[model samples]
Target: MILEIAQLQVKPEQSADFEAAFAQAQRIIAAMPGYLGHELQRCVEQAGHYMLLVRWRTLDDHQVGFRQSAQYQEWRALLHHFYDPFPTVLHYEQVAL
Candidate 1:
């Protein structure tokens, strides 16, 4: 599986609104092809910071399958505006322990 992590910096005053929007946005992503699951975590020390972790069957499942779909536009419309400088997204794979 591919783990997608997003570092989100929301506008200070709009954290509550951002969370609300994400509640709706999550449904959209969850319905996408190859979607495994996800988590949204708020920072303890930084009130306006959030970490979004998503699991996909493959990296292309996110980078192409979801991001390229029309649903992504809806996702962007719902949650994009809440960001300040915008979020940074990265992908990872499990390593043997």
Candidate 2:
């Protein structure tokens, strides 16, 4: 499985709107192929910061299957505007240890 982590820093006054938009946007990602589950977490000290964790069956399932699909455009439209400088997303695999 692959784990996608995005560190999002939303615009200062737009956190509420961002969360509302994300509520709708989450459905789009959940419907994609190889999607397992996801979580959107807000930072306690940083008012406008959030972390998004998504689970997929493979890296391509997220990078190629989802990001390259039309649904990604919809996802981008719904949530991209709230980001401050854009988030950097990274993927990881579980370590046996």
Candidate 3:
């Protein structure tokens, strides 16, 4: 599985709106191909900061399948405006032990 992590920093007073938008946006992502699951977590010390974790079957599932789909436009419209400097998204894979 591929793990996608995004450190989201919203504008100071727009956290609530950001969360509300994300609630709507999540459905779009959840319906994409190869999507496994996702979670959004708020920072304890930073009110406008959040961590988004998403599991995909492969990196292409997120980068190409989702990002290239028309649904991405809706996702962007719903949640992109709340960002400040914009979030950096990275993908990871489990290390065998």
Candidate 4:
């Protein structure tokens, strides 16, 4: 499985809208073929920061299947605008027991 971790720093005033948008976005990603599951959490210390964790059967499932879908365009339009300076998305392969 491929695990994705994204740290997004949203504009202070846009936090609520960002969450709403992300919820809608999650629906799109969740319906894809290789999706496992995902979660989004707000940082307690900093209200405008969020953590997006997602699991996929393969990296190509995300990079090609989901990201290229039309649903993603709408998702990007809604949530990407709320980013303060853009998020950093990293992929990982689990190595822990």
Candidate 5:
């Protein structure tokens, strides 16, 4: 499985709106193919920072299957404006401990 981590920096005073939008946006991603699960974590110390962790069956499932789909555009529209700059998304595979 692949884990996609997005570091999101939302605009100041927009956390409420961002979270509200994300509530709707999360459903869009959850319905996509290869979607395993996800979590949205808000930083206690930093009011406008968040961590979004998404699990996928494969890298392409997220990078290609989801990002390239029309649903992505909806996802973008629902939550993109709240971002100050933009979220940085990175994917990782579990390593043996």
Candidate 6:
């Protein structure tokens, strides 16, 4: 499986709003084909920071399948603007576990 780890640094006072928007946003992603599962986490050290951990059947499932789908637009509309300086999303694969 391909694992995607997205780190989001939200604006100071926008955390609550961002989370609310993401509640709807997650449903869109979860409906997409090839979606395995995901977890969302808030950073303890950085209050406004968040992380999205998702697993896919393959890299293309995320880079192409999900991103190209219309649901992604809704996801972006809801969550993209809440980002402060934007975030870097990286993907990896299981090596040992």
lDDT of each: 0.95, 0.97, 0.95, 0.90, 0.95, 0.91
Alpha-carbon TM-score of each model against the true structure: 0.97, 0.97, 0.97, 0.94, 0.97, 0.96
Expressed as tens digits, the lDDT of each residue in 1-97 for candidate 4 is: 9998999999989898888788778888889889999999899999799999999999999899888989778778878889988999999999997
Q: Per-residue CA lDDT of candidate 3, range 1-97, in tens?
A: 9999999999979998899899999999999999999999999998799999999999999999999999999999999899988999999999985
* Alpha-carbon lDDT of model 6: 0.91
| lDDT score for candidate 1 against the true structure | 0.95
User: Global CA lDDT of candidate 4, please?
Assistant: 0.90
Q: State the lDDT at 65 in candidate 5.
A: 99
Which scores higher on lDDT, 3 or 4? 3
Residues 6-92, candidate 5: write the lDDT tens digits.
Answer: 999999698999999999999999999999999999999987999999999999999899999999999999999998888889999
Candidate 2, residue 11: the lDDT equals 93
Model 2 clash tally, residue pairs: 0
Q: Write the per-residue lDDT of candidate 2 for residues 47-91, one digit (tens) a residue.
A: 899999999999999999999999999999999999988999999
Misplaced by over 4 Å in model 2 are none
TM-score of 1: 0.97
Residue 24 lDDT, candidate 4, scale 0-100? 79
Q: Could you tell me the lDDT of residue 56 within candidate 4?
A: 95
Residue 22 error, candidate 1, Å = 0.6
